[model samples]
Target: MKTAINTAVKTRTLPLAIADFKQITKAGLAFSVVFSSIAGYLLGADQIDLTVLLLLSVGGYFMVGASNAFNQVIEKDLDALMKRTRKRPVPSGRMSVPTALTIASVFTVLGVVTLYVVNPKTAMFGAISIFMYVCMYTPLKTRTPLAVFVGAFPGAIPFMLGWVAATNDFGIEPGTLFMIQFFWQFPHFWAIGWMLDDDYKRAGFKMLPTDKKDTATIIQIIMYTFWMILASVFPVTGLTGTLTLSVPAAVIVFILGLGMLLFAFKLYNNRSNRSARQLMLASVSYITLMQIVYVVDKFL
Candidate 1:
């Protein structure tokens, strides 16, 4: 009977561990990082090595996973109060805090070491990104709305990390990648804030601009969306010099940006949950498609 009970418990807890892993690492977010890193690699490297590419992918995942795990550990208490997050492993007592911390530490160390093997500069930036995200952004989420801006710093680093991994140096090429992603986040996250305004409010998260759904926030989204569109097209214009998209590639990217902008405008005009949700979906599609276009353009 004892052995049977132990087996049952282990079976039940396995799913929780899986769920925890997903929540902590945010596989969706990691996918974006991976894709952007690939874009960086394409832009920076004249010839790609599969081995280096594999290392970069692994190192990127580890860095992002560690940041997410530490985020859960820090936000475990506040997570319980939020409707959208209450059932997470740390909040539900499905995973011990100490165990989570251990996992986070190990992932962080291993991730940095992996990147170091790839290139020291890549490893340094990876460590810095993780530090800013978990140590700074996670804590700032509860305290102020500026956390979003702060978080964008680390969020934008993956694309540049890819460049560094390829070229083993920082320059205008990586700078452009960083700027593009940095501008993209404002609208992306603001739409999320708009969609989950009520839930965030319940958890005392000041994500929305000044906690107001007024013209200011909407205008900010629109402005950032406009800037994102510009930044997305800038590389194609040959203004960035190091990375230039073909004319056909530029046209496709423009259309994608316009599609996302239309949704942003809808959210701004309506300020309804439905509009916000649509913008959120549009934003997701925009980023994914943009990455695809970048890769396709390279090959074509």
Candidate 2:
């Protein structure tokens, strides 16, 4: 399977390098990252500065794109072995290694500088996210099953970066935001790993906690989903500075978490890719909805 995928990638032709560059950055995925950052910022800001929010969106998106590009460049060979990634810019020869590097460098500088203008802490966190993503998470994908765990750090950063940008401090509020996202990533990534287990195996990737859709992995997913729900409700306790949810909003958050857990339980019973796919979709909805809920709760 891997050989066939590699052969296809080797012989592929490009229609346009520019289009491929977009794929290189995984722009579609970056949208969520930017949105999470914006949502975080909105939740933290007393009075929104349009300029700071705009900068955070632009800088956060580009930094995420740069990280994706670097990951593709480094994993071009391994990526070619996976059907899902075989046609990616670097693997399919649509973009050269040097070209990809140049793109990454430009995005990094622009993203970091723009974010720094918002505040030093914001830029500093941005740099740390990119570094961990490109330097740490990217390489660990094939080395150990724990890569998903490492990747969660960078993935969760956007949720708290906005608070840091607004106050120029990493306090309990941002930490609560970070903790919420940190726990949320487990079931999210595990569902994806379960759904793509075969494709990933072709590329020598082992990102799933159990590396297979087994009983133990299902149990872990359920536990993480529960933990995520618990973390999401912490704001209701008023222990986190400037982070509080009213009883009604807390109920809504609980409902969203339960919605995700229902699908997770479905995966547990079926132990199939279909179940995993549904869980993945539920996870997406949960993240987006919960953010909206949190931000809306703040205003109310």
Assess every candidate by TM-score: 0.95, 0.94
lDDT, residue 105, candidate 1? 92
For 251-279, candidate 1 gives per-residue lDDT tens digits of 89889989988988887778798998898
RMSD of each: 1.5, 6.0
lDDT, model 2, position 260 = 95
Index of the highest-TM-score prediction: 1
- Report the C-alpha lDDT of model 2 over 134-225, residue by residue, as the tens digit: 99999899899899899999999999998888889998999999989999999999999998999999999997897777999999999999
Q: Judged by lDDT against the true structure, how good is candidate 2?
A: 0.91
Compared with the true structure, model 2 gives a TM-score of 0.94
- lDDT (C-alpha) at residue 228 in model 1: 83
Candidate 2 regions with alpha-carbon error over 4 angstroms: 1-18
